[model samples]
Target: MEFTEYGFPPDYLDEISSAVQKNDIRDLIEEGLIKAKPIKGTSRARARKADAQRAKGRRKGQGSRREAPTRGTPRSTAG
Candidate 1:
């Protein structure tokens, strides 16, 4: 099968074909032809968990208070 059939980048086709013809299994392994074990969870699940944790840490009213601007300076505002 052509490398493009396996969804590999077209530029890597020559190297991939050479490796296969040379019996260089390392490249195949790196390309995930051989599975070691199934991942426990989907990447989407992991990403969601990470995003939730980050959102929790960014909860409103969590950080040090800024000093109120003195009368002369313009107060900075959020959009």
Candidate 2:
């Protein structure tokens, strides 16, 4: 309904949606909506790219590095 990336249906959605309960993800999963499989993430590729970029003098700024220490951190809640 909101039509975000995860919310909106993809290209092959019609075939799957035709069978499952309309607009309901739970029902679709419960009824086994065309055997959807989880795909592996590209985090490794992204890490490699970041490494390459950093090697080329990118993402080495103050924003990239940790500006503060965990031990010397500020406490949000007073105990």
Candidate 3:
């Protein structure tokens, strides 16, 4: 069969035998004929930096307070 018919270049099929079997791709991978690319992991550098800033009291401000200091009570100046 022409290599172009299978979307492969002519030179690419030159190294492989024309009598290649129709085995499953996973079988080829298990037999070490083919390999899959490694998966990438998410980076935590930004998160760690933010945590360090918070630990140093960098992000603590009025907006971060859980409640007001007076708790909505009216203070008497004389008392």
Candidate 4:
């Protein structure tokens, strides 16, 4: 995918563009013109959202809103 296809920071885009003759950042990094910046804990925004979701404990897999009647707990199975 082209870097232009997605939103990239202006400075990052500039570094990527000037890093190598290729438009792809991966290729530039491979060529050693641009060094990949290490991600700080999955990034600021993503980390925030991930931490919030983790605090909420929504992915415990206990149950979902679409609970089905397993063993006749008073449910109509005739659809």
Candidate 5:
């Protein structure tokens, strides 16, 4: 059977023969010939560094402030 008959494109192969049968494909997979690619983990280098700096109180300065400072109550003098 044509490999494309199963919805796979002509070039979408994982090192297996293009003219293989379904049972043959299963056999190859069972025998460790057809292996799936491993999933990649997200990198936390920058995030971990930021967390470490935050633990050391490095990012709490006024320059990094998010809110405006509150004002004290006003006082008035009467005549």
Candidate 6:
């Protein structure tokens, strides 16, 4: 049976296989096909750093400049 029969998104099959090969069972559990006991030793810091790097890479590839904040008349500070 295809993975989609088990309620998983079909497009994620390759990613799921790669995660299994890398010993990342947590990802499978998160996908909700089976219950998994929690495992220790995963690097949370490294995950955050990797995510930041990916975001930076995406922004660099897009090559779009961020718009500067607009300037307008200052509003009264009083409520």
Task: Evaluate all candidate structures by whole-model CA lDDT and list the values in order.
Answer: 0.56, 0.60, 0.59, 0.56, 0.63, 0.57
Q: For residues 1-79, write the lDDT of model 6, one tens digit per residue.
A: 2345445557666766677443476657665643434456767997798779878875443245444333232556323
Q: Report the Cα lDDT for candidate 6.
A: 0.57
For model 6 the TM-score comes to 0.27
Task: Give per-residue CA lDDT, model 1, range 14-53, as digits (tens).
Answer: 6556775435757566775433554467568877876797
Candidate 4 least-lDDT 10 residues: 1-10
Candidate 5 lDDT (Cα, 0 to 1): 0.63
* Strongest candidate by TM-score: 5
**Scored by Cα lDDT, where does model 3 land?**
0.59
Best by lDDT: 5
TM-score of each: 0.25, 0.31, 0.45, 0.22, 0.49, 0.27
Tens-place lDDT per residue, model 3, 1-79, is: 2335444446544433442566654454455444454566899999999899999988787676688676545686323
Model 4 pairs in collision: none
Candidate 1: residue 73 Cα off by (Å)? 92
Deviation of model 5 at 7, angstroms? 22
Error of 6 at 17 (Å): 1.2
Worst 10 residues of 1 by lDDT: 58-67
Write the residue-wise lDDT of candidate 4 on 1-79 in tens digits.
3233334444466665565444566775665545545455744887788779868986545453356536434457544
Instruction: Give one clash count per candidate, in the order shown.
Output: 0, 0, 0, 0, 0, 0
Angstrom error at residue 55, model 1: 42
Q: Model 2 lDDT vs. the true structure?
A: 0.60
Deviation in angstroms for 4 in model 2?
28
Give every collision pair in model 6.
Answer: none
Candidate 6 worst ten-residue window by lDDT? 64-73
Model 2 C-alpha lDDT per residue in residues 22-71, reported as the tens digit of each score: 55666766655434545766668888988899999999766677765443
